[model samples]
Target: MDTVTHTFFGLTLYAAVKKEGWSRKEKTAFFVTAVGGSQIPDIDVISSWWDTAGRYQMWHRGLTHSVFLVPIWAALFSAISWLFWKVKGWKLYGLGVLAVLIHDTSDLFNAWGTGYLEPFSTQRITFGTIPIVDLTLWAIMLGGLLYAKLRKISRPHRVYKLVWLLMACHFIAQSAQGYALYEQHAGRYEQFALSAGFVPGQFQMIGKKNGVVEISNATAFTEPKLQVELKSQESADLDKLFAANPKAKTLYEWSPFVVLVDNEKQIGLYDPRFYRNGQSFLFEAIEKDLKQGK
Candidate 1:
């Protein structure tokens, strides 16, 4: 999920809490715990400034987003709350855990996956069942806010709780449809990935077989329409490319599969999952002459 979605998750979590008769200081402490924990995992973005080896691709959502770091982050947030607000309790720690957990888990459902297991495993766990920016979720949250305001309810936390429930249902529905589409096309390819489209109930199916990659638009209620076919140069030697452009090596490791491009002019590879507009945004290339020091 994107930054906006994560922030909203924090806000919704805060709103869902029952704060009846709570002091303003206690409320502020909880708010900080919720929102800060939600946004802290993305601190890995700073690695880019020191990324001389072009390994930012692997480091951005890497160890910081790991499940192992959740408790550490929660403890830090809890301690910070105690220091600033003088509010000390397990409730703050628990809310921090929930906020961080939501951040890490929500990322798994998108195309840009996270290193959930981290040191235990380096796999990018992605379900791709939800878009990075889910408008439906935003709508649900917005609607909840409107309903609470218009109804002038004495207890507004109930409204936010309902919002969370609706959001969960949306997630389950999207994942179910994505799974069905995956099963529907599983036999056609040796390897596959699903990228949920902007609109709900739609997906981009990327499947690779032998050295050929097929990208298609698919939905549960409709036949998958062929989008494009990409051929990977499986036999190409990437030693020079990796040596010349280290980012290419990281990209190669980060992606589940790559479409290799080796020709007279240059050698490179790109993730087919992000293919669009006649090119892939994740592509990394190096000129043959540059590699040869010409």
Candidate 2:
């Protein structure tokens, strides 16, 4: 999820709390607890400055986003809130933990996955069922906000809680549909990647098998339609590429799946899931010496 969405999650979590009978200072502390924890995991972005070894690709959503780090972030935020507002309670710590959990878990639904189990495991877990920016979530949250405002409800927090229910339903629906489509063509492809389509229930499914890649659009209610087909030259020598662009090597290792390219003049690899229109931004190449690796 994007920073804005995470920030919204924080705000919504804060709003969903029943803060009645609390002092102004206490409310402020809880507010900081919710919003701060939500954004804190993203602190990994700062590692890019010191990353000269192409580890930034692995660092961006790395250790900081780890599930193991959730309680650590929560306790840190709780301590800060305790010092600043003198509001001491296990509730604050629990809120902080939930906020951070929401941040990390939401990221797993997108194609650009997070290192959720990092420090223990570097696997980038992604369901690729939801877009990085899901308008459906925005709409659901905004609609809840609007209804709460208009309905003269006794407990507006309930509305926000319902919004959470809606968000969960949306995620489950998207994931289930994507899983069905991926299973639909199960034994055919060696690797598969799913990208959420702009329209709900539609997905761009990328499958790679036997050095060939297939890109297609699939809908839960209909059969998949072939969109583009690409060939992957996996046998191409990547030693020169690894020697030239170290980041390319990191990308190759970091990505869940990739498309290898061995054009006439150069050899490279790119993530097929990011293939948009004609090219992929992840494409990394180095000039080829046909005779060297021959």
User: Highest TM-score among the candidates is held by which one?
Assistant: 1
* Tens digit per residue, CA lDDT, model 1, 1-294: 999999999999999999999999899999999999999999999999999999999998899999999999999998998899999798889999999999999999998889999989999999989999999999999999999999998999999999999999999999999999988897899889999998999999999999999999999889999999999998877888899999999999998889999888878999998999999999999877866654
The lDDT values for all models are 0.93, 0.89
Candidate 1 residue runs with Cα over 4 Å from true position? 290-294
lDDT of 2: 0.89
- RMSD in order of candidates: 1.6, 1.8
How many backbone clashes are present in model 2?
0
Q: Per-residue lDDT tens digits of candidate 2, residues 1-294?
A: 999889889989998999888899999999999999899999989988888887788888889999999999999988998788888789999999999999999999998899999888888998889998888888988898889889878899999999999999999999999989878875689988898976778888888889999999888779889998999898887887898888889898888888888877888899888899889988888876778853
